[model samples]
Target: MIRAARILFKATLWFVVLSVLWVGLYALVPPPFTLTMAGDLFQGRSITKDWTPLADIDPDMPRAAIAGEDARFCLHHGFDWRAIAGAAARNAQGRRIRGGSTISQQTAKNAFLWQGGGYLRKALEAWFTTLIELIWGKRRIMEVYLNLAETGIGTYGVEAGSIRYFDHSAARLTPTEAGRIAAVLPLPKKRAAIDPRGFVRRHGNAIAARVGVVRRQGLDACLK
Candidate 1:
């Protein structure tokens, strides 16, 4: 029993040390690829990605993303309690299991955790989200999230999405174009940002309006 306890303690210590070092390293350097990217490659899906700095990406891209995914992104410190509470209440009423994950949480999941819904994944995502909020700050968190998010089936990042969908550089995307990209974020594989129609078109328009609102209200001032 004592020997088993010693092994468990040593394993726990190593896990903590490694996790800290990993997060610290990523806080400084951009990750070359994510687990999702690797999984796609392993599954024989052609991955298309171009890593672009936040400065190189159009300013509207981040605004649209924040507007669509997490309106209170800059206000929260990794988690948005109000959104969580609302989602929980809705779920308890037998509604769809919509998530209230903020951009920070999404970044943590995309960068470190695998794609899926589970308690263990949520716990790890929460831990990494807190670490990033403490170390990477709002700007870096948005930067990483923009670059790592799956924009389409086998397409990753704004750069790739821009080139594939709009035939333009990410830095040159207009607000409408950026909004369209943001619109498909929830179900990228099933939506197209270039020639959005029906629901996507309307949703993209809404996100574009919210982008303006966020800009005027300084909702993302923390990134500045």
Candidate 2:
């Protein structure tokens, strides 16, 4: 039993060290690929992505993301307890399941982990989220999230999604365009940013409107 405990301790120590190094390296470098990207490739899907720096991408894009996804992105460290409580209460009502994960958490999951939910995954996500919040900061977190998030089926990143949907670069996305892209982010495989209908269209429009609010209220202050 003592030998087994010692082995486990060594393994955990190595894990912490390696994970720290990985996070540190990614702070200075864009992650080359993620597990989700590999999953798409294995399924015979053609991946489309372009890693545009946050400065090169339009400011509206992040604003739209913050408005539509996490309004408290700038205010929180890595988690928002109020959002979590709200999501939990809503979930208890038996509606569509919602997650209270902040943009930082999403970045950690996309950059270093896989999709889907499990207790183990959630715990790991929390760990990485803390590391990123401390090491990567908000600006880096937003940058990585925009670059790594799946914006459409077989498409990753705002730059690729922008070109595919609007035939233009992300650097010049209009508010409407950015909001539409952000709307499709939550369910990229099922939604279309261009010519969206029903909920997607409404959500996109709402997000577009909130883009102005995000800017006015400085909700995206962290990025600056």
lDDT per residue as tens, model 1, 133-199: 9888999999899889999999999999999998989999888999999998888889999879999
* lDDT of predicted model 1: 0.91
Name the Cα RMSD for model 1: 1.3
**Highest lDDT scorer:** 2
Tens digit of per-residue lDDT, candidate 2, span 124-147: 999999999999999999999999
Tell me each candidate's TM-score: 0.95, 0.99
Q: Alpha carbon lDDT of residue 111, candidate 2?
A: 93
Candidate 1 deviant stretches above 4 angstroms = none
Best-fitting candidate, scored by TM-score: 2
The lDDT for every candidate, in the order shown, is: 0.91, 0.96
